[model samples]
Target: MTNPTSPRRHLPTSPFRTAAPPPAKRFAVGDRVSHDEFGLGRAISVEGDGTIAVLVDFGSRQERITAPFAKLFLL
Candidate 1:
């Protein structure tokens, strides 16, 4: 059996080689954005350097979206 504490073999085609996560989404005030559920909206404000949440104003309502904005996309 292979030792669990041993160094991992680096395979050229291994998916684990790249262990970095994707870049976070950044939005500035007044920037236009689209959401999966909230639809289109304008960025009103951001909190915690945008790592906490983002306030967006939709025509019908407003929402505070959090980090790792999967449904939120830049327009």
Candidate 2:
């Protein structure tokens, strides 16, 4: 049985090339970004090469956005 927490591997001979996952988003300090909730902001600080956490200044307030960055988009 396979563990539910483990990712399933794609078969080499499989024809489903579209099943490949997209690359993780990368960010850097001083980069412009937008968020679903925060509107617009600029990266103030980044943790662990921007994959861990990012500090952003959204003018009205600052937020510490975390990984996966679901609502965050690079600009």
Candidate 3:
């Protein structure tokens, strides 16, 4: 018999793991990009420094979004 409140056990495995189907790379500063939900816009800035950032466009009045470089596809 086991204690009902006992902590669950987990199998030992490699701590370091690689991401599957690595994210796509697109949209650099000065590059044009279009979002399915945000419509067309240009890459204003990238956040996370090494990850992604919120694209800004003054003409369309679109909001900024934090999207990963891999998830963003170049136009």
Question: Can you give the TM-score per candidate against the true fold?
Answer: 0.71, 0.76, 0.49
lDDT value for model 1: 0.88
As for candidate 1, its clashing pairs are none
Q: Which candidate order results from sorting by lDDT in descending order?
A: 2, 1, 3
- Output the lDDT of residue 24, model 1: 79
Candidate 1 per-residue lDDT, tens place, 8-62, comes to 7678988676566788788888889999998999999998876678999999898
Candidate 2 overall lDDT versus native: 0.93
The digit string of per-residue lDDT tens for model 3 on 1-75 reads 999999655446857554466654644566677666666677676666525565657365855566554344457
**Reference-based TM-score, model 2:** 0.76
Tens-digit lDDT track of model 2 for 1-75 = 779999777798988774657788889999999999989999999999999999999999999999999999999
How far does residue 75 in candidate 3 sit from its true spot (Å)?
1.0
Candidate 1: where are CA atoms >4 Å away? 1-16
- What's the C-alpha lDDT at position 6 in model 3? 92
Compare candidates 2 and 3 on TM-score and give the better one: 2
How many clashes would you count in candidate 1?
0
User: What's the residue-level lDDT of 32 in candidate 3?
Assistant: 73
